[model samples]
Target: MPTQSDSTPTESARLLGRTRPAVRIAGYSAVLRTRALLTLAVLIAILCTLFALDISTGEFHIPLGRVLDVLGGGGSRAQRFVIFDSRLPRALTAVIVGAALGLAGAITQSILHNPLASPDILGITSGASCGAVLILAGTGGATTGIAATLGIPLAALAGGLLTAVAIYLLAWGRTTTGDHGVMGFRLVLIGIGVNAALLSVVSWLLTRATLTDAAHAQLWLTGSLDRSDWSTLVPAGIGLGITLLIAAASSRTLAALRFGTDTTRVLGVRIQTQQALLLGAGVIAAALATAAAGPVGFVGLAAPQIARRLLRTPGEPIVASTLIGAIAVVGADLVSRTILPVDLPVGVVTAAVGGPFMLYLLVRANRKATL
Candidate 1:
C-alpha cells in the first residue's frame, strides 16, 4: 500500500533509484527539486562564462573567440602558450580552490548545525596559515632549497589536519547511555579558542622574519592565486575529485544527519561513524584548498550560505555550494585582477565584499532567534 506519508517531503521515503537519466541513486524522494536544479544549472552557466572571460582578460588580451580557439587547439603558438600555460591555470585554480572551500564549509556547517561553522571559523585555515608562515619565516621567505614553495603546502596540510583532529577530540562527548561524539556548540567554542592561538603563532612568526620574508609570507597568507601554476592545479584538481566522490557516497548519511541525532540513530545511521567520516572529508577539502591557495578567506565562509539561500535545500546544499564557490572565486578574481588598476589579492576582494554580507546575515539570523 502506498503510504499517505508520500504526500509529505521524502523524509519518510525509503530511497529513490534511477530517478533520472544521468542522475542515479539517491535517498529521499525530494532529492531532486526543480527550483534547486535550475539554480545549479544557472550557476554552472555563469561559471563557464566567467571562466572564458577570465582567460581572455590578461595582459595579452585574447578575445573570447581567440581564447576558445586556443582552448580548442586552433590558435597560434603564442596564443596557445598564453592561454594554456598562463591564464588557464590561474582561472582553473580559482574555480577548484573555491569549490573545495565551499564544499568543506557546507559539510562543517551542516554537521555543526550553524551557518558560521566554516573552515575559517573552525581554526582549520588559521592552523594552515600558521604552518605555512612558520616555513616561510624559518626558510627566509620560502626561497631556500626545497623549503621554499614545497614546504609551505606540506606544512599547511599537516597543520590543518592536526588542528581538525584536536578539535574533534576536544569536542567528543560521552552520554549517560554510553554513547560518545561531538556537540555542535562545544565544537565551535573549542574551534574559536584554537583559532586565536594559531593566529597568535602566525603573528609571532611574521614578526620574527625579515622584511622580504615577511612580505612573501603575508602576500601568500592573503590567499591570492598569484602563485598558482600546474603544480598547484594538479593536486587541487585531484583533491576536488576525491571530495566529490566522498560527498556523493555520503549524501544519504548527511541527509539523515540533517534530521537531528535522535532521528539519525532511529534511521540506522551509525552516528559516530558518519560524523567522523564527514568531518574528515571536510577537513581534507579545506586543507587541500589551503595547500593550493593559502587559505582564501570567506569563500568557505560565505559560499555555502549563499547557496542555501538561493537553492532553499532541505538538506545541505553541497553541490550547489560547490558550484557557487567556484563562481564566487572566479568572479572575485576577475574583479581583483581587472576592475582594479592594481592586481589586488583575490582574498581581499572576497573579504571586502563578503564581510558586509556576513554581517547582514548575522543580524537577520539574530532577529529570528537568540544565539
Candidate 2:
C-alpha cells in the first residue's frame, strides 16, 4: 500500500542482507530481539559474577576486587596459589561439565522430539555412573591418585558409548506402516531397563567392597565435587571444544531431524547414519561430563528446556542451553556450599529443583493434549 521508496522495515533489512536494525556493521547483520539480547547479556554478567564468587567466597573469603586482581595476574603468592590451584579448577570444571551436559541434552531432545529425553533417558549417564562405581569398588577408595583421575573417566566413556550403541540396536525396527527408523519410545524403555540392571550391579559391587570404598562410591553417586581438580577440568574443556565444533557443523542436519525422519530424508540426510553421528557426539559430551562430575542429575534435563523457554526458540537453543547449564551447576554449587549447614551435593539440589519442574511440564503436556 506504500508508494515508491517507502519499503517496509523488514523488506529494507532483507534487501540489505540483514535482519536487526541495531546490529549492522560493515555489510554484516544479525537478527535478535532487544529484550532477548539484554537477557543474554544479563545472564553472561551473572555467570561472571558467580564464577568470581565461586573462586573468592570460601573459608579464605577473598574479596571480589582482589579476585579480579588475581585473575589479571596481580595477587600475592598465597592468593595466586589458592585461586590457580584449588578454586579455579573446580569452577571451570563445573562450567565446562555443565556445558557438555546441556549440549548433549539439546541433541537428544531434538532427535527424540521429547522434552524429557536426556543422557539419563538414553542410559549414558547411568552407564557412566555404573562404570565409575565399579572403579571405586575395585580400587578400595583409591580416588586420590592418578588412577582416579584417568581410569574412572576412561571407563565411564567406554560405558556411555556402549550403552548408546546398545540402545540404538534395541530400538531399531521397521514400523507396521513399513517405515524403518529408530523408535524413541523403545529406546527410552530399553534404556530404563539397562539403567536398573546397572544400578543393581553397582549396589552389589559396593556391598562386596571395603567400607571406605563403599563410602567413596556413595559420595560419587551423589555427584559431589569434593575431588574436582585440574585433571577433571582439562579433559572436560577438551571435550566441550570438540562438541561445540561438531554441533555447529551438524546443526543443519540436526535441525532437519527435529522435523521427523521423513523431513530429514527429504533433505538428503541418510537417516540412520546422521542419527548415529549426532547421537555419538551427544554421547561423547554426556560421557565426558559424567566422567568429570559424577552424573550431576537433572542439569541435562533442565538446562535445554529452560533455555528454549527463555529464548523462545522453535528448535533447541544450544548456546543458551549451555549457558543455562553453567548457571545451574555453579549456582547449585554455591547453594550447597553456603546456604545449608551441611554440605549437600550439587546434584541433590538440582534434583530437588528439576523433579518438580519435570512434573509440572508433564502436567502441562497432558493438559495441552486434553485441549
In model 1, the runs with Cα more than 4 Å from the true position are 1-32, 140-150, 174-179
Writing each residue's lDDT as its tens digit, candidate 1 over 1-371 gives: 78665554454353443354244456534334667778888999999999999999978898899888778779999999888888998999999999999999899888788888899989999987877788767765545335544666678778888999999899888743467778888898999899999998888889999988888888888888987777777667776888788889988888888777788899999987888888888887787788777878888878888888897766459999999899989999999888998898888888898889879878988889874
lDDT of 1 at 189: 91
lDDT of each: 0.83, 0.83
In candidate 2, how many Å is residue 43 off?
2.2
Model 1 RMSD, rounded to 1 decimal = 4.8
Candidate 2: tens digits of C-alpha lDDT, residues 8-113: 8888878887445567789956666876777688878988888888899788889999999999999899999999998898898888888899889998888877
Per-residue lDDT of 214 in model 2: 91
What TM-score does candidate 2 reach? Answer: 0.90
* Superposed Cα deviation of residue 193, candidate 2 (Å): 2.5
Q: What is the lDDT of residue 366 in candidate 1?
A: 89
Kindly report which residue stretches of model 2 are placed more than 4 angstroms away from their true locations once superposed: 1-36, 143-146
TM-score of each: 0.88, 0.90
Whole-model lDDT, model 1: 0.83
Q: Which candidate is the best by TM-score?
A: 2
